[model samples]
Target: MEFDYIIIGAGSAGCVLANRLSADPHISVCLLEAGPEDTSPLIHTPVGVAAILPTRHVNWAFNTTEQRGLNNKLGYQPRGKTLGGSSSINGMIYIRGHRTDYDDWKALGNTEWGYEEVLPYFRKSESYYGGTNQYHGTEGELFVSRLQLHGVTKDFIEAGISAGHSHNADFNGEEQEGVGAYDVTIHKGKRWSTASAFLKPIREQRSNLKVITGALAERIILDGKKAVGVSIRQKGKSRQLKARKEVLLSAGAFGSPHLLMLSGIGPAEELAPQGIAVLHELPGVGQHLQDHPDVVISYRSPDTSLLGVSVSGSAKIGATLWQYLRHKTGSYASNCAEGGAFLKTDPNLDRPDIQLHSVIALLDDHNRKLHWGHGFSCHICVLRPKSVGSVGLTSSDPAVAPKIDPNLLGQEEDLQTLLKGYRMALEIIKQAPMAKYQLQDIYSADALTDEQLSEVIRARADSIYHPVGTCKMGRDENAVVDSHLKVHGIDNLRVVDASVMPTLVGGNTNAGTIMIAERAAEWIMQDQATA
Candidate 1:
């Protein structure tokens, strides 16, 4: 098969890219996804995230290398392996990070990525249900709305305010510091993934677009210095698809870097040891890994209103499910993590360095561990960590999982920040509104000393599902992609995904990832126009 563009990984970015690039009738675009189509009913239900997160069903349940920082525990990395990618299986919270995140990118020589310049792209991908404003859009494909506030979620917000934090209705608004309900990517009663937002509406109408699922991209087919096609394996058969214009990698942070290395375009030493010939010597193919190291503080709540596996909880869910099926409202339509906050560890910091998620469930170890009764949990993560890690080849085979080492909490500063955030979470729980719901403390106490609390943090803290910077975009020596998202020393190849983020954003990365694709699609179109 041949096309003008071949986009690998039909994830958050690829969906948007396919929609925008295929808009012109003159060009053809083929999108390759390693996973199956998003046909599962669980994918569209807002509460189905609980069932999807801990299993391998439509999820690339990858595991990180044992980190010495976490006492040699292998952390779990769950990525979406279906059409919409992580957006189909994520928490569905809509966050754009801090404005300074983009400004910092501009400072790093990416002049087009500054806050003022990228805001339009951010607005372009969102159809804010709250109506359009200076910072939001009302006509975009992706739906952003406020979920019906749960009683516990409202109480959590009240507790935050009582704890001296300000109440923010929109974290993506004038400021990102405050405790409030989050804006989620939900429409009506369903989880509005990129597939539903961007691809679904245009899939049947666009004859030039071809979406191939269950296609594992083995490597990019390079003709000398230029990328011309992709070799893929599907249904026990190997085939090659040609790209007449460009090959865009939107396989996300881990998959993009892994594919680049598998295609002999990464560090020489790493590929050579894996028996892969190096076609290009890009030392930064998978360096500078960053993620939000999160620690959850949970409590056993007698409030049957919260989600759990107990009898009453199950009964409540059954009723809510019926309500959702009928009216598209109720607790079943919740994202679970209905409320959150962004705050600074140090009061004098210019922006929030820590983020909080108030989950209406007893979430332990990414829901890998379950409890009997109803409860509430709060997740605290350092927005930016000083520690950096890398992604490397485990083998030359594309099917083999990459060696992911986030090196979370490898730096003392990260641990300190998490410790402070943990303390802040405890303080909020102590407020009357939240304290009333606490039946028993399931994690730690406020009286724990700094040393004791640090140990607790080190033992429990892991990723909050935000990972970026493996294939960072910049003009620095380690940059894999330039400001236009084109590979530094490659032709007709660009990576449009979270992997190109020069730095980790201050919040959830879904909104930012979609914005990146919107901006890249415009540039790609502009280049095509000139060509």
Candidate 2:
């Protein structure tokens, strides 16, 4: 059956597209999600992000094949497989990233994506509890609220301030630099993902919007050079759904570009070797992979930190359960990542070279295996990494995960920046207010000198969970899509997710991804009107 629009992958962008596009009663929209419905209780609780990470219920637990940069250790990369995508299971920090990040997008030939032009779209998608202002809008769907910090978390924030960094209450407000507790995509202590904010309210109201869960799209169906429809696998049966107007790909950084290549629209040289016939030799479909790599600096605390207490004993579990029953507040309510900072690793750098995520717990290896006992830790990540990477097909089969080579720590300067960030984190732990906790360096800072620490930084650094630019947007020869997120050679198709980002944002990628979707929805609707 043909529809006005067929949006693929019901993630952050796809949910917004369904809500906005289906607003017109006359236009019919079909939204497809590869995973199941987002019914898990863990999804609503902001703190439940940890419990769902290892499971495949709403997660695509993808791992990289032994990164040479990280001493050949394979890093785990998790993406959301539910209706809300990664938004369903992610650290709920509500960061829009630096304004300069967006300005850089305009500089890269995407004129319609300047900071000034994109600000309205950011505002249009937010319902900030901090109130309406020039920088924020309170009348939108997604919830943005002030963080409810615990006693230990409060101490960590002061520790950052006592170390010479000023406290900036709101990262999304006036300035982004400095250490402070972060605002999150939570409201009154509950998670407010795109499913909660955008989809729930309009799901029943919009009969024109048909949502299909557990429908995995194999590839785009092409008629000549244009994307006519999508071929999907549902209940072990292959079905074809046509898009009368357009087939919008909002499958995110990994999925969108993979689908593009699967449909025979990627680089000819790369595709021909795999025995896949190239319908279009668009060289940049699955290139330009970018992510923020984080290194941890751990410290043993005076008392059992939030991290220790959460995993301790039956008493701790009982107390948290009682607290949650009584007031919907306690250990369970806090997203482990309580505070963070945007700082410059070197004073001479153009902007903040590193971003810090101060977690109330101690984690090692991205918290999958090996956690520290009764300790606190800080994650120092190199924002705007100089390192570049790529995503490519591992096999001809569409079911196989793509080979993701982030090429982390490839540059000498990247190793230096991370080491500097580690040193800065240690300096913060030594400050007076923070020192009251009597923090002990469990990671053994004294054991490693400056030179050795750089080695450790390169060996242990992992992604801060922000991945973008697989399908970069620009006008260059290597560009996959144009400024409007439309594929350069294909008509009536658009890639409107984080895949369209020419580079990763300065901070968390969620807010920027949502903003892109919001703006893209406007562009699509406007184009439809003109057509």
Candidate 3:
């Protein structure tokens, strides 16, 4: 079968691409997703994200090799496998990151990628609950909103107000350096995933857009040096599908680079040693890997925390039923990461370098216990990590996981920034308003000194769930893609996902990734018209 465009992953980026590209009615687009449908009840029920994290059903729970810097500890990395990808299973925090983050891309020679240029595309895809603005779009497909109803969140907001930092009305508003309960990708208390907000709504009308789930793309079928199509395996059978115009790779940070290398488009030195034929000899296919690693600062709460309510025996179960019956609201509908802030780690830095996520529950080792009590934890993450890593092919086998080494905390600056963030978090907890909540420091009471805290930070740092830049786009020779997202060494082949980020954004990658795809779709369509 042949398609005008074949998008490899039906994730956040691919969903937007499918919609925008198929809108022509003349063009036929086929979107393939390796995971099953986004039908998990846990996915839609915002708070269910915590429950879905450890499961293999919707998440690809990949772990990294031991980091030599972090006392040889392996880090747990989770990628969404469902239709909407990570947007469907993530914490649902809607953050676009710093404006300068995009401007930095322009400085790197990507002219069309400045913050002001991409802001419209960001607004174009967002259906903001708040009215449209110069920075926010109101009539777009992706849903964004403030919490409709939440109890613990209200308390946390008050605590922030008492903590001395500015209480921001909107994190996506005029200013970003304040504490506030975050806006989320939810509609009427249910998680509005990319599949729900974009793809599902227009599925039936778009007969030209065909979506295939449970189909894993093995590699791009190259005709000489060009990506002509993809070879996919599904139900124990292999099928060949051709792309007439382009084979767009939206397979994300992990899948996209692997497909490129499998199709013979990576570093020759690396592929040759793995018994894989190198087609393009491009050395930068998966060279720049980045992610935000965070450490949890937890305390024992003197009051009833959401964790206690959700985990208590019959009373907890009864309260959930009661809340659900009354207003379709309860702990079941919150996306866990209710409170967040983008702040500067130090005055000397150019932009806000830290992000904090306040959750009303006890999260010990990724929430891996049935134990429940009144507890609170704030996740402190360095927004701009100095350390860089890479993603490489383990073998020619499609089933093998790609080797991911984020090389976290590789630089002295990264450690110092994160250490400063940790200090600021403690300061917030000690403030008048938060102090009234009777938050007792529990994680490291034994390590009270600054030097001891540094040890604690290094020992327990984990990902805040933003991973990007494996196949970076720029004007440099080592760049894998051009400014327009087209592969550097191939024609009619582009990577339109988080993998192409030149640098990790100062906040969540979901919003930035979706905007990239929205812009990429326009670029592809406009190029088609000109051609």
Best model per lDDT? 1
lDDT of 2: 0.84
User: Which of the numbered candidates is closest to the native, going by highest TM-score?
Assistant: 1
Give the lowest summed-lDDT range of ten residues in model 3: 305-314
What TM-score would you give candidate 1 relative to the actual structure? 0.99
Clashing residue pairs for model 1? none
- Comparing 1 and 3 by TM-score, which wins? 1
lDDT of 2 at 236: 86
Model 1 lDDT tens row, 42-150: 8998989999999999999999999888888999899999999999999999999999999999999999999999999989988998898999998899999999888
Compared with the true structure, what per-residue lDDT tens digits does model 3 show for residues 4-98? 99999988899999999999999999999999999998888887888888667688888887876576788778788988998888899899888
TM-score of each: 0.99, 0.97, 0.96
lDDT scores of the candidates, listed in order: 0.93, 0.84, 0.84
Per-residue accuracy of model 2 over 1-531 as CA lDDT, tens digit each: 789899998888899999999999999999999999899889988778877776676898888767777888887788999989999999988888898889899999899888899999999998888789999998899988876787667877788888888898888877888898888888767888898888889998888999999998888999998889999989989999999999999988888888888889898766776778899889888889998888887766646535564345447768876886688787677788888889987678676778888777666666665444556778888888888888888776667787888878777777888888888888877777676666676555664698788767766787877889988999998898889889998898899899889987889999999999999888899998999
Compared with the true structure, model 3 gives a TM-score of 0.96
Off by over 4 Å in 2: 309-313, 370-372
- Whole-model lDDT, model 1: 0.93
